[model samples]
Target: MSSTTLVIGGTGKTGRKVVQQLRALGEPVRIGSRRNSPPFDWENPATWPAALAGIDRLYVSFQPDLAVPGAAKAISDLTYLAVAGGVRKVVLLSGKGEQEAERCERIVADSGIPYTILRASWFSQNFSESFLMEPILSGTVALPKPEAPIPYVDTGDIAEVAVQSLLDDRHDGRIYELTGPRQLTFPEVVEEIAAATRRYIRYVPVPLEEYVEGLRNHDLPPDYVWLIGYLFGEVLGKPGNEDVSGDIERVLGRPARDFSDYVRETADSGIWNRVPSSS
Candidate 1:
């Protein structure tokens, strides 16, 4: 309880929730971000030790994602430094279906530091807070994998498990593959949102190549385009990823938030209905 925890990607979806919950509990939390007073940049290793200083526990949520190329090495290097910096425990957030993410998980496990791994499914917040938000607001949720149902876990569930892992040694050396209670396909997700918001929303299923080209037309960077293609084509396209785990209930003693609940709550927040201002 006396430990100061460092949250990498502190401003991110689950990272922000973790920081908020920890601070509300009067737990000492350090925001590890490139824009922080002492910036922590993933591409720059020099900023790492400064952020890890005086941090007893670490919550690592890698930016972009652990599935991207070079992520395993980065996690490896950071875990090595974290152990050397006297960090006692680490809770790493990882992608469930990504082989690259699993490789990064192995790096953290082999670092000689006590670790908890949350290999999580896709996030429910992606519809409200991430790249998918723009498409949803545009009334068309277009992408590949219209048939694949993803058990999108709530970011809050992920954060709660992370906090418990950071504080409890009992979770050490455990890998929790977290997900919601059910799976929802792209069209089903849109239907939920449309019902909740009373708006007309379309789920358009396009070819992977077309989706990539659309992203390019929108001027999304090439790296981002590749990441999207990898996620939709490789990760989501996998059949076994439609799994639901009891890890959220196991770790937090409560059921994970369903996608319908997420849609309803997010609708009340007006995020899906917000009108973009003229630039």
Candidate 2:
């Protein structure tokens, strides 16, 4: 019997794409999620063994983020469990320039199981598929730093690299810093979307504290608020995260998708023009 390849967070951005590519190749895959046959919840340990059972390979995409508190320990424990469970290979999706994310990378590296690390920049899909979507829909993209340019990588490229890493041992022990072809600040990103969708989306600069208060007004949890604050304030607000990387091209043997192309494609999908139904 072929060992099942377990994709943790399988329904999430990159995980879902990874699962799709793997299934397309006819690989035996078990999606590890709260809704799976043996549901896998990161906060729950008993769910670990059942999820790891009969799995030969694993793709780890930690939810919230690896920078959150206790994420390193969780990753370490989970990697240990995977090794003990006879899993041979592991591919970890990590964040670039985050110390905590690097710590989690070290955990996977030292796990004694062959592994690949994809330290990715911010995802481009945040504008369409995540928190920024609402602000985009509202026609105003507000953030703490409008000038900080991020080399936002595409989740699709990340997924492609992830699938290759899981199947090919050549990627083992390799740490690929995946980034987009260029950097774009929040304002520039909004401009691209506006041009692509032919809408008058504006970029507004909001203080970090005000952003947190706004999140609270929406009744978001404390941890979620902290995560968002950390991502924007500590990660994007800081310097040294805006460099373009050639690793995507090196690994996939193709140039990383440009932000303009992303905007154009996403715009063509009509997601940007979607109207919120009146409740």
Candidate 3:
């Protein structure tokens, strides 16, 4: 009998992929989103129990990020509920080299439930699907840590590993440091997209403070501004973050998707080629 799995951030970048893969495998899946029936919300603890009621396994992708303040407590609380609610296994999507996210990892580790932790370096989709998309579309990708070589793992890889962890007991009690096959600096990344899309995209290196200030000037949330700063300063600025990991290949028996591959695929999708709508 297939156990029903609850995907905490089911509608998010990796969560949606996890849900799709699990469903394609004929496994029962429940999306834990505010808009779903028996909604599961991070800020509303009351909604968690109903969502966890019949869930035997869980995929935890915390909203915003696990590095944010109070994230540890939330993970701890969720883990406690899950254990008591008969959840047999858990898979947490965690950020690599993030100190605060590590605190949350420890909570899940000691929860007494079988678990797997996927500490991912960065997502290659950021350029096409996230904050960096605006800059790319603007043709001027300005940011800090221009020289920080990042092995940006693909979300599809992360999702596959996550599904494997949830279904396969061999992954339990294991922590996988997931990364791309190679590293690329910010400018190199921009160049790859430019070459793939045939667009003139320029990369500008700025001070971390200036970048954060620009986010603030755009009227972004205070926490988001702080998180961007934290990620750039603490994660990217930290040495050795550029190092590649073979965990994805070890688990999947295939090489992790390279950034250039991601660029080519995304470029083919015509997302980068779309002209920015002047609203």
lDDT of 2 by residue, 146-200 (tens): 7788998999999999999999999999999999999988899998899899998
Off by over 4 Å in 1: 277-279
What is the TM-score of candidate 1? 0.96
Count the clashes in each prediction: 0, 0, 0
Which ten contiguous residues of candidate 1 have the minimum total lDDT? 270-279
Q: Write the per-residue lDDT of candidate 1 for residues 1-279, one digit (tens) a residue.
A: 488999998999999999999999899999999999789999899999899989899999997889888887888889888888989999999898888688888888888889999999999999888878888888878888798889999999999999999988999999999999999889889998998988899998899899899889988877788888988888895868778889999889889988888888899998888774332
> Each prediction's TM-score against the native?
0.96, 0.96, 0.98
Q: lDDT per model, in order?
A: 0.89, 0.89, 0.92
Q: Which wins on lDDT, candidate 2 or candidate 3?
A: 3
lDDT of 1 at 93: 93
Q: Show the colliding residue pairs in model 1.
A: none
